[model samples]
Target: MNGHQIGEKVAVKVGTDMDEYSKPVELEGILKSKGDLLGYLNATNDKVGEVCTLSIGNLDVIIANRGDSFITINHFTRAGVEIEDYDVIVVKQGYLFDELSAISKLDILAMTPGSTYQRIENIDYKNIPRPIFPMELA
Candidate 1:
Protein backbone atom coordinates (compact mmCIF):
# COMPACT_ATOMS: atom_id res chain seq x y z
CA MET A 1 0.00 0.00 0.00
CA ASN A 2 2.94 2.31 0.61
CA GLY A 3 3.88 2.25 -3.06
CA HIS A 4 0.26 2.65 -4.14
CA GLN A 5 -0.04 5.67 -1.87
CA ILE A 6 3.00 7.14 -3.63
CA GLY A 7 2.05 5.93 -7.12
CA GLU A 8 4.99 3.60 -7.67
CA LYS A 9 4.46 0.16 -9.18
CA VAL A 10 6.20 -2.60 -7.17
CA ALA A 11 7.37 -6.16 -7.78
CA VAL A 12 10.14 -8.59 -6.88
CA LYS A 13 13.18 -7.90 -9.06
CA VAL A 14 13.77 -11.61 -9.91
CA GLY A 15 17.09 -12.99 -8.71
CA THR A 16 18.64 -16.35 -7.79
CA ASP A 17 18.25 -16.60 -4.02
CA MET A 18 15.01 -14.61 -4.04
CA ASP A 19 12.84 -17.62 -4.78
CA GLU A 20 12.34 -18.22 -1.09
CA TYR A 21 9.11 -16.35 -1.63
CA SER A 22 8.39 -18.06 -4.95
CA LYS A 23 4.70 -17.86 -4.28
CA PRO A 24 2.86 -14.62 -4.80
CA VAL A 25 2.70 -12.16 -1.97
CA GLU A 26 -0.16 -9.70 -1.43
CA LEU A 27 0.83 -6.08 -2.07
CA GLU A 28 -0.23 -2.93 -3.91
CA GLY A 29 0.97 -0.54 -6.65
CA ILE A 30 1.04 -3.59 -8.97
CA LEU A 31 3.99 -5.66 -10.10
CA LYS A 32 5.65 -3.52 -12.73
CA SER A 33 9.41 -4.13 -12.86
CA LYS A 34 12.16 -6.66 -12.42
CA GLY A 35 15.35 -5.31 -10.87
CA ASP A 36 17.34 -5.11 -7.69
CA LEU A 37 15.96 -2.97 -4.91
CA LEU A 38 19.39 -1.60 -4.02
CA GLY A 39 20.20 -0.86 -7.63
CA TYR A 40 16.87 0.88 -8.11
CA LEU A 41 17.27 2.83 -4.89
CA ASN A 42 20.78 3.78 -5.88
CA ALA A 43 19.65 4.86 -9.31
CA THR A 44 16.76 6.87 -7.90
CA ASN A 45 19.01 8.49 -5.34
CA ASP A 46 21.98 8.80 -7.65
CA LYS A 47 22.38 12.46 -6.84
CA VAL A 48 22.19 11.97 -3.10
CA GLY A 49 23.81 9.73 -0.50
CA GLU A 50 21.14 9.95 2.16
CA VAL A 51 19.36 6.73 1.09
CA CYS A 52 21.01 3.52 2.31
CA THR A 53 19.97 -0.11 2.74
CA LEU A 54 21.16 -3.19 4.56
CA SER A 55 21.03 -6.44 2.61
CA ILE A 56 22.40 -9.71 4.04
CA GLY A 57 22.28 -11.71 0.85
CA ASN A 58 24.51 -11.86 -2.19
CA LEU A 59 23.91 -12.52 -5.89
CA ASP A 60 20.95 -11.34 -8.01
CA VAL A 61 18.14 -10.71 -5.53
CA ILE A 62 14.61 -9.50 -6.08
CA ILE A 63 13.70 -6.05 -4.79
CA ALA A 64 10.48 -4.58 -3.47
CA ASN A 65 9.68 -1.75 -1.07
CA ARG A 66 6.48 -3.11 0.44
CA GLY A 67 6.94 -5.94 2.95
CA ASP A 68 10.61 -4.98 2.75
CA SER A 69 12.71 -3.20 5.32
CA PHE A 70 15.38 -0.48 5.33
CA ILE A 71 18.06 0.24 7.81
CA THR A 72 19.64 3.53 8.77
CA ILE A 73 21.25 5.65 6.09
CA ASN A 74 24.27 5.84 8.36
CA HIS A 75 25.41 3.33 10.95
CA PHE A 76 24.70 5.41 14.05
CA THR A 77 21.14 6.66 13.64
CA ARG A 78 17.55 5.44 13.58
CA ALA A 79 16.78 2.39 11.37
CA GLY A 80 14.39 3.89 8.83
CA VAL A 81 13.69 7.02 6.77
CA GLU A 82 10.74 7.88 8.99
CA ILE A 83 10.07 5.67 12.04
CA GLU A 84 7.79 7.94 14.01
CA ASP A 85 4.49 6.26 13.05
CA TYR A 86 4.88 2.51 13.57
CA ASP A 87 3.12 1.05 16.58
CA VAL A 88 4.83 -2.33 16.85
CA ILE A 89 8.10 -1.06 15.54
CA VAL A 90 10.43 -3.75 14.26
CA VAL A 91 14.10 -2.92 14.28
CA LYS A 92 16.93 -5.39 13.84
CA GLN A 93 18.74 -5.48 17.16
CA GLY A 94 19.22 -7.49 20.31
CA TYR A 95 18.54 -4.37 22.34
CA LEU A 96 16.95 -0.93 22.11
CA PHE A 97 18.02 2.53 23.18
CA ASP A 98 16.45 4.43 26.10
CA GLU A 99 14.45 6.82 23.94
CA LEU A 100 12.92 4.08 21.76
CA SER A 101 12.25 1.94 24.79
CA ALA A 102 10.39 4.69 26.64
CA ILE A 103 7.43 4.75 24.22
CA SER A 104 7.21 0.99 23.79
CA LYS A 105 4.77 -1.08 25.79
CA LEU A 106 6.29 -4.47 25.03
CA ASP A 107 9.33 -5.86 23.26
CA ILE A 108 9.75 -9.07 21.32
CA LEU A 109 13.04 -10.59 20.25
CA ALA A 110 13.07 -12.39 16.92
CA MET A 111 16.38 -14.15 16.44
CA THR A 112 17.70 -14.07 12.90
CA PRO A 113 20.80 -15.42 11.18
CA GLY A 114 23.63 -13.14 12.27
CA SER A 115 26.89 -13.35 14.21
CA THR A 116 25.01 -15.24 16.91
CA TYR A 117 23.24 -17.61 14.56
CA GLN A 118 22.32 -21.24 15.36
CA ARG A 119 23.79 -20.80 18.87
CA ILE A 120 25.36 -24.11 19.99
CA GLU A 121 24.95 -25.63 16.53
CA ASN A 122 27.35 -23.23 14.85
CA ILE A 123 29.92 -23.60 17.61
CA ASP A 124 32.74 -26.16 17.53
CA TYR A 125 31.73 -28.58 20.21
CA LYS A 126 34.24 -31.41 20.51
CA ASN A 127 32.84 -32.80 23.77
CA ILE A 128 29.16 -31.88 23.71
CA PRO A 129 26.18 -34.09 22.81
CA ARG A 130 26.42 -36.21 19.70
CA PRO A 131 24.01 -36.76 16.77
CA ILE A 132 23.11 -33.12 16.38
CA PHE A 133 21.08 -31.85 13.49
CA PRO A 134 22.69 -30.58 10.18
CA MET A 135 26.23 -31.16 11.40
CA GLU A 136 25.35 -34.70 12.38
CA LEU A 137 22.47 -35.34 10.03
CA ALA A 138 23.37 -38.37 7.99
Candidate 2:
Protein backbone atom coordinates (compact mmCIF):
# COMPACT_ATOMS: atom_id res chain seq x y z
CA MET A 1 0.00 0.00 0.00
CA ASN A 2 2.82 2.41 0.97
CA GLY A 3 5.10 1.56 -2.00
CA HIS A 4 2.86 0.60 -4.88
CA GLN A 5 2.55 2.05 -8.37
CA ILE A 6 -0.72 2.77 -10.17
CA GLY A 7 -1.85 0.16 -12.74
CA GLU A 8 0.86 -2.01 -11.26
CA LYS A 9 -1.69 -2.75 -8.56
CA VAL A 10 -5.49 -3.07 -8.47
CA ALA A 11 -7.06 -0.27 -6.40
CA VAL A 12 -10.84 -0.07 -6.04
CA LYS A 13 -12.72 2.56 -4.06
CA VAL A 14 -16.33 1.54 -3.37
CA GLY A 15 -18.77 4.17 -2.03
CA THR A 16 -21.60 1.87 -0.93
CA ASP A 17 -22.12 -0.46 1.96
CA MET A 18 -20.80 -3.96 1.25
CA ASP A 19 -23.50 -5.52 3.40
CA GLU A 20 -26.13 -4.54 0.83
CA TYR A 21 -24.28 -6.59 -1.82
CA SER A 22 -24.13 -9.88 0.10
CA LYS A 23 -20.73 -10.95 -1.26
CA PRO A 24 -20.60 -14.73 -1.75
CA VAL A 25 -17.26 -16.31 -0.82
CA GLU A 26 -17.00 -18.88 -3.66
CA LEU A 27 -18.54 -17.01 -6.57
CA GLU A 28 -17.53 -13.97 -8.62
CA GLY A 29 -19.42 -11.19 -10.44
CA ILE A 30 -22.31 -9.17 -9.15
CA LEU A 31 -25.49 -11.03 -8.34
CA LYS A 32 -27.50 -7.97 -7.30
CA SER A 33 -27.53 -4.15 -6.98
CA LYS A 34 -30.36 -3.81 -9.57
CA GLY A 35 -27.94 -4.74 -12.41
CA ASP A 36 -26.02 -1.49 -11.86
CA LEU A 37 -22.56 -0.97 -10.32
CA LEU A 38 -19.93 -3.76 -10.34
CA GLY A 39 -21.12 -5.86 -7.39
CA TYR A 40 -18.36 -8.44 -7.68
CA LEU A 41 -15.46 -6.60 -6.06
CA ASN A 42 -15.43 -8.96 -3.03
CA ALA A 43 -15.31 -12.31 -4.83
CA THR A 44 -13.61 -10.94 -7.91
CA ASN A 45 -10.64 -10.21 -5.71
CA ASP A 46 -9.94 -13.93 -5.53
CA LYS A 47 -9.16 -14.03 -9.24
CA VAL A 48 -6.71 -11.15 -8.92
CA GLY A 49 -5.23 -12.70 -5.76
CA GLU A 50 -4.16 -10.73 -2.68
CA VAL A 51 -6.67 -7.94 -3.29
CA CYS A 52 -7.03 -5.60 -0.31
CA THR A 53 -10.24 -3.68 0.42
CA LEU A 54 -10.24 -0.67 2.73
CA SER A 55 -13.60 0.38 4.16
CA ILE A 56 -13.77 3.99 5.29
CA GLY A 57 -16.73 3.60 7.61
CA ASN A 58 -20.10 3.27 5.76
CA LEU A 59 -19.54 5.98 3.18
CA ASP A 60 -16.84 4.12 1.23
CA VAL A 61 -14.62 1.07 0.71
CA ILE A 62 -11.51 0.46 -1.34
CA ILE A 63 -9.96 -2.70 -2.80
CA ALA A 64 -6.25 -2.71 -3.66
CA ASN A 65 -4.15 -5.45 -5.20
CA ARG A 66 -0.77 -5.78 -6.82
CA GLY A 67 -0.33 -5.73 -10.64
CA ASP A 68 -3.35 -3.69 -11.76
CA SER A 69 -5.06 -0.59 -10.42
CA PHE A 70 -8.79 0.19 -10.84
CA ILE A 71 -11.45 1.88 -8.70
CA THR A 72 -15.10 0.89 -8.17
CA ILE A 73 -17.02 3.57 -6.35
CA ASN A 74 -20.75 2.69 -6.05
CA HIS A 75 -21.72 6.33 -5.65
CA PHE A 76 -21.22 8.66 -8.62
CA THR A 77 -21.06 11.81 -6.49
CA ARG A 78 -17.86 11.07 -4.61
CA ALA A 79 -16.28 14.49 -4.05
CA GLY A 80 -14.20 13.21 -1.14
CA VAL A 81 -11.84 11.67 -3.67
CA GLU A 82 -9.81 13.87 -5.98
CA ILE A 83 -10.56 11.86 -9.15
CA GLU A 84 -8.04 14.04 -11.02
CA ASP A 85 -5.34 12.31 -8.99
CA TYR A 86 -5.86 9.03 -10.79
CA ASP A 87 -4.77 8.34 -14.36
CA VAL A 88 -8.04 6.52 -15.17
CA ILE A 89 -11.13 6.56 -13.01
CA VAL A 90 -14.15 4.40 -13.78
CA VAL A 91 -17.46 5.63 -12.41
CA LYS A 92 -20.08 2.97 -13.24
CA GLN A 93 -23.00 5.35 -13.48
CA GLY A 94 -25.17 6.18 -16.50
CA TYR A 95 -24.27 9.89 -16.19
CA LEU A 96 -21.64 11.70 -14.17
CA PHE A 97 -22.88 13.35 -10.99
CA ASP A 98 -22.41 17.12 -10.60
CA GLU A 99 -19.46 16.69 -8.24
CA LEU A 100 -17.59 14.32 -10.56
CA SER A 101 -18.65 16.14 -13.73
CA ALA A 102 -16.96 19.38 -12.59
CA ILE A 103 -13.39 17.95 -12.51
CA SER A 104 -13.85 15.24 -15.14
CA LYS A 105 -11.70 15.90 -18.19
CA LEU A 106 -13.09 13.06 -20.33
CA ASP A 107 -16.22 11.34 -19.14
CA ILE A 108 -17.79 8.56 -21.15
CA LEU A 109 -20.77 6.22 -20.98
CA ALA A 110 -19.59 2.60 -20.96
CA MET A 111 -22.65 0.42 -21.44
CA THR A 112 -22.34 -3.32 -20.85
CA PRO A 113 -24.54 -6.04 -22.37
CA GLY A 114 -27.65 -6.36 -20.22
CA SER A 115 -31.43 -5.98 -20.16
CA THR A 116 -31.68 -2.20 -20.19
CA TYR A 117 -35.30 -1.40 -19.32
CA GLN A 118 -34.63 2.20 -20.25
CA ARG A 119 -38.16 2.06 -21.66
CA ILE A 120 -41.22 0.24 -20.42
CA GLU A 121 -42.84 -2.43 -22.64
CA ASN A 122 -44.34 -5.95 -22.84
CA ILE A 123 -47.24 -5.33 -20.50
CA ASP A 124 -50.94 -6.14 -20.77
CA TYR A 125 -53.41 -3.32 -20.21
CA LYS A 126 -56.86 -4.22 -19.02
CA ASN A 127 -58.48 -1.17 -20.60
CA ILE A 128 -56.56 1.71 -22.08
CA PRO A 129 -56.31 3.88 -25.20
CA ARG A 130 -54.47 2.29 -28.15
CA PRO A 131 -52.40 5.42 -28.76
CA ILE A 132 -50.79 7.26 -25.85
CA PHE A 133 -49.05 10.05 -27.81
CA PRO A 134 -50.95 12.90 -29.45
CA MET A 135 -50.92 12.89 -33.27
CA GLU A 136 -50.41 16.65 -33.50
CA LEU A 137 -48.40 19.17 -31.48
CA ALA A 138 -49.89 22.51 -30.32
Candidate 3:
Protein backbone atom coordinates (compact mmCIF):
# COMPACT_ATOMS: atom_id res chain seq x y z
CA MET A 1 0.00 0.00 0.00
CA ASN A 2 1.87 3.06 -1.27
CA GLY A 3 -0.77 5.39 0.26
CA HIS A 4 -2.99 5.48 -2.82
CA GLN A 5 -6.70 5.05 -2.16
CA ILE A 6 -8.57 2.04 -3.49
CA GLY A 7 -10.67 3.91 -6.02
CA GLU A 8 -8.60 7.01 -6.72
CA LYS A 9 -8.54 8.18 -10.33
CA VAL A 10 -5.16 9.70 -11.18
CA ALA A 11 -3.67 10.45 -14.57
CA VAL A 12 -0.42 8.81 -15.57
CA LYS A 13 1.91 8.65 -18.56
CA VAL A 14 3.18 5.10 -18.56
CA GLY A 15 5.54 3.22 -20.89
CA THR A 16 4.29 0.55 -23.30
CA ASP A 17 5.81 -1.59 -25.99
CA MET A 18 5.86 -0.19 -29.56
CA ASP A 19 6.90 -3.34 -31.35
CA GLU A 20 3.60 -3.67 -33.18
CA TYR A 21 3.75 -0.10 -34.50
CA SER A 22 7.19 -0.67 -36.01
CA LYS A 23 6.17 -3.63 -38.13
CA PRO A 24 5.88 -3.15 -41.90
CA VAL A 25 2.38 -3.13 -43.34
CA GLU A 26 -0.01 -1.36 -45.71
CA LEU A 27 -3.42 0.13 -44.99
CA GLU A 28 -5.92 2.26 -46.94
CA GLY A 29 -3.43 2.59 -49.88
CA ILE A 30 -0.59 3.93 -47.72
CA LEU A 31 2.30 1.79 -46.55
CA LYS A 32 2.72 2.09 -42.81
CA SER A 33 2.58 0.15 -39.61
CA LYS A 34 -0.46 -2.05 -39.09
CA GLY A 35 -1.36 -0.03 -36.02
CA ASP A 36 -2.38 2.99 -38.18
CA LEU A 37 -5.97 1.84 -38.31
CA LEU A 38 -6.66 4.26 -35.52
CA GLY A 39 -10.28 5.07 -36.34
CA TYR A 40 -11.04 1.78 -38.01
CA LEU A 41 -12.68 -1.17 -36.33
CA ASN A 42 -11.40 -4.78 -36.07
CA ALA A 43 -7.77 -3.72 -36.05
CA THR A 44 -4.99 -5.18 -33.91
CA ASN A 45 -5.47 -5.78 -30.20
CA ASP A 46 -3.52 -2.60 -29.34
CA LYS A 47 -5.44 -0.28 -31.65
CA VAL A 48 -5.71 3.39 -30.69
CA GLY A 49 -9.25 3.18 -29.35
CA GLU A 50 -8.55 0.11 -27.30
CA VAL A 51 -8.39 0.32 -23.52
CA CYS A 52 -5.99 -1.31 -21.05
CA THR A 53 -6.05 -1.75 -17.32
CA LEU A 54 -3.07 -0.48 -15.34
CA SER A 55 -2.93 -1.23 -11.64
CA ILE A 56 -1.14 1.36 -9.56
CA GLY A 57 -0.92 1.08 -5.79
CA ASN A 58 -4.47 -0.09 -4.94
CA LEU A 59 -6.17 1.70 -7.81
CA ASP A 60 -6.83 0.56 -11.35
CA VAL A 61 -6.26 3.06 -14.13
CA ILE A 62 -7.86 2.56 -17.51
CA ILE A 63 -5.65 3.49 -20.45
CA ALA A 64 -8.02 4.70 -23.16
CA ASN A 65 -5.58 5.23 -26.01
CA ARG A 66 -2.27 3.88 -27.23
CA GLY A 67 -0.27 5.61 -29.93
CA ASP A 68 3.22 6.73 -30.91
CA SER A 69 2.83 10.41 -29.98
CA PHE A 70 0.63 10.37 -26.83
CA ILE A 71 3.59 11.14 -24.57
CA THR A 72 3.15 14.87 -25.29
CA ILE A 73 0.91 16.80 -22.88
CA ASN A 74 -1.05 18.23 -25.79
CA HIS A 75 -2.43 14.81 -26.59
CA PHE A 76 -4.04 14.52 -23.18
CA THR A 77 -5.63 17.95 -23.55
CA ARG A 78 -6.86 17.06 -27.02
CA ALA A 79 -8.35 13.85 -25.67
CA GLY A 80 -10.58 15.94 -23.34
CA VAL A 81 -8.83 15.01 -20.11
CA GLU A 82 -7.62 17.99 -18.13
CA ILE A 83 -4.29 17.60 -16.33
CA GLU A 84 -5.45 19.54 -13.28
CA ASP A 85 -8.37 17.19 -12.60
CA TYR A 86 -6.16 14.53 -11.09
CA ASP A 87 -4.33 14.54 -7.76
CA VAL A 88 -1.17 12.86 -9.11
CA ILE A 89 0.12 12.20 -12.61
CA VAL A 90 2.95 9.72 -13.07
CA VAL A 91 5.02 10.30 -16.16
CA LYS A 92 7.91 8.12 -17.27
CA GLN A 93 9.79 10.56 -19.50
CA GLY A 94 12.16 12.79 -17.53
CA TYR A 95 11.98 15.50 -20.20
CA LEU A 96 8.21 15.73 -19.80
CA PHE A 97 8.55 16.59 -16.10
CA ASP A 98 9.67 20.13 -16.97
CA GLU A 99 6.59 20.78 -19.06
CA LEU A 100 4.16 19.17 -16.59
CA SER A 101 5.69 21.14 -13.71
CA ALA A 102 4.23 24.35 -15.12
CA ILE A 103 0.73 23.11 -14.23
CA SER A 104 1.46 21.13 -11.04
CA LYS A 105 2.96 22.69 -7.91
CA LEU A 106 5.30 19.84 -6.95
CA ASP A 107 7.36 17.54 -9.18
CA ILE A 108 9.43 14.55 -8.15
CA LEU A 109 12.10 12.65 -10.07
CA ALA A 110 12.25 8.96 -9.20
CA MET A 111 14.48 6.36 -10.84
CA THR A 112 14.24 2.61 -10.46
CA PRO A 113 17.08 0.92 -8.62
CA GLY A 114 19.51 -1.17 -10.78
CA SER A 115 18.44 0.67 -13.92
CA THR A 116 20.99 2.20 -16.32
CA TYR A 117 20.28 5.68 -14.95
CA GLN A 118 20.94 4.66 -11.33
CA ARG A 119 23.84 6.35 -9.51
CA ILE A 120 27.19 4.81 -10.45
CA GLU A 121 28.68 5.63 -7.04
CA ASN A 122 26.18 3.38 -5.26
CA ILE A 123 27.04 0.29 -7.31
CA ASP A 124 29.68 -2.06 -5.93
CA TYR A 125 31.75 -2.98 -8.98
CA LYS A 126 33.71 -5.95 -7.73
CA ASN A 127 34.87 -7.06 -11.19
CA ILE A 128 36.53 -3.77 -12.17
CA PRO A 129 40.30 -3.78 -11.53
CA ARG A 130 40.82 0.00 -11.69
CA PRO A 131 39.26 2.88 -9.74
CA ILE A 132 36.77 5.00 -11.71
CA PHE A 133 36.64 8.78 -11.94
CA PRO A 134 33.92 10.49 -9.83
CA MET A 135 32.94 7.18 -8.24
CA GLU A 136 36.20 7.08 -6.27
CA LEU A 137 35.75 10.66 -5.03
CA ALA A 138 32.17 10.03 -3.95
Please name the candidate that would achieve the greatest TM-score relative to the true structure. Answer: 3
Kindly indicate the candidate among 2 and 3 with the higher lDDT.
3
The top-ranked prediction according to lDDT is 3
| Candidate-wise lDDT, in order | 0.38, 0.36, 0.42
TM-score of 2: 0.30
| Candidate 1 C-alpha lDDT tens digits along 1-138 | 233322244433322343342445533233322222232122242222222222222211223333323332321122222344334456544555555566569966666644333455545457767677766775
For model 1, the superposed segments whose C-alpha errors exceed 4 Å read 1-5, 12-81, 115-138
Question: Residue 85 in model 1: shift from native, Å?
Answer: 2.0
Model 3 / residue 136 / CA error / Å: 10
Give the alpha carbon lDDT tens digit for every residue of 24-126 in model 2.
2322222111111222333342333233333233323333233232334322112134334456666443465555566668887765322321233422335
How many clashes in each structure? 1, 4, 0
Between candidates 2 and 3, the TM-score winner: 3
- Evaluate model 3: give its TM-score: 0.37
**Candidate 2: regions farther than 4 A off:** 1-82, 114-138
